[model samples]
Target: MTRKIFKQFFLALVALLSVTFALTTLATADTSNLAAENVDITFGTTVDADLPAGSLLKLNQPAGAIYPLHNSTGKLLSRGIAGDASTAPSLTTDQIKLDVQSGNVYYQVLPDCWLQSDSTVTLLDSTGQAPTDPVALTLKFVDANGKEIQDAKTFDAQFSTTTDATTLATLETELLAIRPAVTGYNLVSADQAEHVITYHYAKPTISTGSTTVATQPSDPVTTTTPIPAKTEPVAVKGTAIYATKKIGLYTSPNFSKATRKIWYQKKQRQNRPQFVVIGYAKSRSGQLRYKIRDINHHSLTNNRRGYITANATYVTSLYYHQNPKKIQVISGHGLNAYQAVTLHGRKLHHYRKGATLEVKAVKTHGLTTRLVLSNGHYITANKTMVIKR
Candidate 1:
């Protein structure tokens, strides 16, 4: 009986010890998690780091320990903050955002991290210490004719952690102050975007007619001028002429008669005036000109009949000049073959890049130009979208 009681007591002690060990392990795990959550993470200022221009910077953690970075989906981006002075993580990016309320800056610095800023980080100078490599901002000068006036100019534009509208506007103002002036051209509009700055200039029209016309019909001429034989005007049917750029609209075939009534602007490719050709007239100067009537509905020059240059440089046939058996799509995002020439209607099909399509004919309308496929559907004839095979 004594041995039995001793064994039972021993069994009870063993059970108590097992339960205590389990409870201690659970408590320790909970405490460890709490400590991790309470770790004092801090980001130092630029003064604490040795940052080399155009090189990777090594940030010193003098006050707090660095922690792993995570993305929005809770995916780990970095094991910890980078310590290398010569090489950062290959995935580290310069894209960053600034928190105004906390006066802290947040960086991606990792491929997957969507980091948020806290009070630990500080703001750097707006003009100094760019977060990323400088972006190439292109400045293009274009005339009213939609042609480049000169070679495009480019400059490096740097940004801080965040860019707001006011900051962008200020930068634009500073950049515009350096615009080069062109003779006989007045700046009409300056369009500004993040990476592109376009300045459109207009040149005032000057009379090209000679003022030396005979005041008296009986006045003796210095030399006799030979008159050329009369040429019959050629009739055109079902064709149109489009101004490749801005061209003058004349009331008569002869430019010496008067100055252009109006300058037809080619602001939008799809909405430009489409002049329906009726016939071709030879000017007194021996240049052939297109007798056209503007059929662009709702345009300022709509229904206005006039003469335009026949030079292929300034004007082009509304339809494709040559017929091709096949064409290939060149646009990266793929071109949408529409039901009609207009972009307002439903998309018939989408032709991906390098997609070869059979062509039936090329057609044009007031809205835009399109390629009529063999399947009776229309796709864009935009040179940027497709190419003849």
Candidate 2:
């Protein structure tokens, strides 16, 4: 009877000890799922370290269901669907799809969506510093489809020391990086459970294409050419009084028939008085005397040397005659013969219907009273016109 009693007591003690050990093991184990009901998604400036083992933190998204994140410089980091929790938060995947769809797994980091390692983001206090505890971290959530949800779709969750800070920081950084690119989504809420924090991101607006890209420039320089100058006019002078029917030079004292000629010669760099009747010529071989034409300086056909009388007329007037009293038709019409006289400073070269006198004064008479054909003409003192020589 003593042995039996001892065995029964020992057995009961063993059972009790086993039960106690089992209870302690159960209590000490990570019961993250146990406080799921008590876990309230709240926004605080800092996270508390003394939450229950199984406690869960939740986040309430903004009504618009979109969350935007920006750097201190206001540059866009990333954008995608937010608050829909079911999709992986990735630059390549759509975050909004996971929220509405079943069997979707959440991803902490997406390729190409995270900030460059050298960049830093600070979770500030209301004063913009890292708060010690119960600090609210604004998390920008994106779905698998990369659409931005409304602000009401955001999440806010409290974190404690019992919660993993490394994991929380990583999540926070990702959310911050992505928020700036969130076009149609808003932040709903965030929940924390032990070492894991879940973000509920929602979409308020839908978008199709990606953001705009920029362009760059090239290298090397360029150049161009310049222009040239213009040509000047030449001067001409002479004493020969050659005339066409329109332009005539006659004797000074007597106004009578003298000589009728065509061709006239001119020299270069000579300053003759303006409107002084000099020579006569024609525009063509058979044409009658017209007027004194233009005087050209150089001649290309004459081996580029200067030449006169190259252009002449059929009928030209000659005023300088050896015997002025005798009438002579050197070229054309005798009735058209006349004389040029200088009275005072003014010159009267055209004669009246009937005037006869002697050639008492002959001024600078060079060429004989001969008729020569030319290609140009000139103007008379009477204001009669001539063609070009």
Candidate 3:
């Protein structure tokens, strides 16, 4: 019996030792999986990585390829590699660009992909020199009528005769950044040219005039006809007119009352109240009134038909009535070309500032005129937007 007990105890001891050995092997395997392998990386020696762990970098990539650029904190930043347009780096290229830094900065090509001393990264100086032909830039502040309100400010140091797109765009951005504030005058337009920038401001206008209504009268009211006082016509049919002072728009030729009115507001740079003469209506006192249709877009009284004063002092012809032999876009912002005379549909094209376009024809649409272009597009005939060249 003692011999049997001894054998059982010996078997139990062997089983425990076997279990402990298996547990020790599993613990050693877990430790090996958790540790990171040491890698020797050299960035400048070669373009391609030789190690099995290092990422494979391609050589002779085109310029402007999107790369996985990283910041100091390993944050990814997308940037294009530098090169010429014809030979620029393609989008799929694995090339990267590094800006010269002051201290030790890390440039990560990809996740866990790095070049320490094995790859050669070339850096180029990108700073451009200033142009030698610098010119004086004049900023003219004018009122709504193109009359100067303040002395012209000249910045001789801020401008150069650089024709590059980046230089011109930077110059314009700097010009607007330093604009002086003028109290009691709201800026209307900033017309920019090669050397001159004209800023139009509208002064606060306080005038004494008859109050006008917004909506038109449903029915025309008859009034007693007075004896004739004046007989000569102020303007004939199809004449374009603009208000010099506040004016009322009457439903009829007679001065019964103004169903609607136009205020003397020229705050907008290109937009002003203008109309085309349809016919004439003689008031009771025989005062000639211009029967008109509103053509100023975005105006509350746009497209309305009424009779207005024909006094040359109050209403006058637009700058030009006929199509110019040649026209150029003068507005700082480019003008839109339309498919039709009326600006009702989507714009057909946009002509940038300083573009010269040939005029094909001019037609009267809603009293205002539209210039048909040589390219079969329509643009506004307003003098403020385009200049006769």
TM-score against native, each model:
0.30, 0.14, 0.30
- Model 1 per-residue lDDT tens digits across residues 1-389: 69999998876665445334423432332110110110011111110011122222223333123435554333455444422212222121122322111122233333333233433332233343425543555768798777997677664333332433333333343233233444555556566677676867666444548543322223221111111123532223335656768888785567744746788876454445677654344566768766567877887667676678877677765555455779888777888877766754898788889899999887755424678899988877765457789
Candidate 3 local distance difference test against the native: 0.49
**Candidate 1: where are CA atoms >4 Å away?**
1-235, 257-259, 266-272, 324-389
Which is the winner by lDDT between candidate 2 and candidate 3? Answer: 3
**Could you give candidate 3's per-residue lDDT for residues 235-310 as a string of tens digits?**
4344566765567777555665454444445434345478866544455675777667787777666767667888
Given candidate 3, what's the lDDT at residue 1? Answer: 60
lDDT: the better of candidates 1 and 2: 1
- Two-way TM-score contest, 1 vs 2, winner: 1
Location of the lowest summed lDDT over 10 successive residues in candidate 2: 220-229
lDDT of each residue in 148-181, candidate 2, tens digit only: 3423223333333334353344334222212122
Weakest lDDT window of 10 consecutive positions for candidate 3? 34-43
Error of 2 at 72 (Å): 75
